[model samples]
Target: MRRTSLHDCPAPAKLNLFLHVNGRRADGYHLLQTVFQMVDHGDLLHFDLRADERIVRTTDVPGVPEQGDLIVRALLLLQAAYARRHGHPPQGIDVAIDKRLPMGGGLGGGSSDAATALMAANALWEAGFSREELMALALPLGADIPFFIFGQTAFAEGVGEALLPVEAPDCWYVVIEPGVAVPTAAIFCSEHLTRDTKPVRITDFSRHTMNRTDSTGFGKNDLQAVAVSLFPPVAQAIDWLSAHGDARMTGSGACVFCAFSSEAEADTVLQQVPGIWRAWKAKALMHHPLNTVLQVSAVIE
Candidate 1:
């Protein structure tokens, strides 16, 4: 009997250590600078190659359209590209996603899933696309998608596509999800959004600036003020988390996190959070878990 080619992959969520909007593009996209740190808490994906040439999702993902599911779209994108280049359709794969990261929590769960699909499909299909090429495809999927393709802690700039790998300290995070969805575009488009903050150099980031070691001192989230003003739940979450430790809003809004020196400390905060609110204690990752998975697979093969 042929050995089953089991491919299990992780879709890690990200925390925006800090986000600053300094400008807006001519095409209406906002210019930004942020540090993206991967976290241990996220959704999981498992893949199995299929004999048929059609991509299928074995797991049901509600509230996401069939055609628009990032995983499905990512598979199709790779399939079409492989067909065009290789003169034949690539073998299809059945994708199973075990969702853990909360949706619309600014955890980059969706983008991470999309990246996992891209990486897994590329491997399963035997496509010879380089990481750079894969990231190019990832960009249109979501602003946060490309970083997962790179799979490392990065100082992101230029609407979050430009990446510079950074070595971040290992730390524990207390993430609190207020159980509400904050519209990202609405926050960005708000009249109250700040768009004229000055930018800082990557090397200039120091502990004294923000008194925070995990964030890039480049800037603050331009959308944060707008998010906090419009969404009282977000503000409440931030205030609640900050009362225990150093708390900051991740991404646009809806999720706020506190940093702790130890897992025990994080657990303490996690316990204090009300049972009605969604909360987790996860470690900050300096690199993406997917990268480690890929590297190990290479060695195994």
Candidate 2:
């Protein structure tokens, strides 16, 4: 095995506070309003720097194309952007991703993976790309990619690209995955999907929000109904979870999460869930773990 410099990074999952399809754009993107909170549950990526200007993945991700890997694309985008800015290309690095998050679960795993690559490559290659510049590059990869680069709780809108940082309540999440893949594009393109929601203000969020206790005000995913209709397993998972606690789909479908005020509460629910379904008890993270790693790297420089 060729030894390489260690650049370990995290790829965290995101939960949708609420998803509203306000409308669709002429370009075919759905306009949306939602809050994105990072969770501790996600994949871990370990990067190794190489002298050659070639990008490679040491690990294979099931269901995702190797040639179209977002991590490689992110690194290439960073390399190109830096080369253009400084008038010189930098050395390349090989990435090894430990993909724990399930594909097509609407957990923002792919986007987070891409963000980790961008951040880690920036450090290893000595490319001084600002968060704003990285975010600009991330948007073309995926709308949720930018939020992971920003790496905080945020109010998201405009096809989930526009972001406004916000402070969210601390809570634990009981996330359940049904071992099924939900296609995001199919949900967005469904004719039955709700797309005429009135625009909401941030203040409106407070009025319609739910507590860990009430569970009533926690908003709905406008795409949930459409997703459930398409994927019955998603509805089954949500129904099973809702029986134990307040359950809602995180993004579009396939994964549903319930909120708990305490770890005990979350664990209790986790215990009762059937083993056939993949589940985890994780707390909402105020900051991404990679953020701390980036900070320490900055100090070393």
Off by over 4 Å in 2: 1-4, 207-216, 296-301
Candidate No. with top lDDT: 2
In terms of TM-score, the best-performing candidate is 2
If scored against the real structure, what TM-score would every candidate get? Answer: 0.92, 0.93
Instruction: Give the per-residue lDDT digits (tens) of candidate 2, residues 55-122.
Output: 88888777677679888888888888988988988777777877789888989999899998888787
Supply the global lDDT for candidate 1.
Answer: 0.80
Candidate 1: the clashing residue pairs are: 19-220, 19-221
lDDT of 1 at 55: 80
For all candidates in order, the CA lDDT equals 0.80, 0.82
Off by over 4 Å in 1: 1-7, 206-219, 296-301
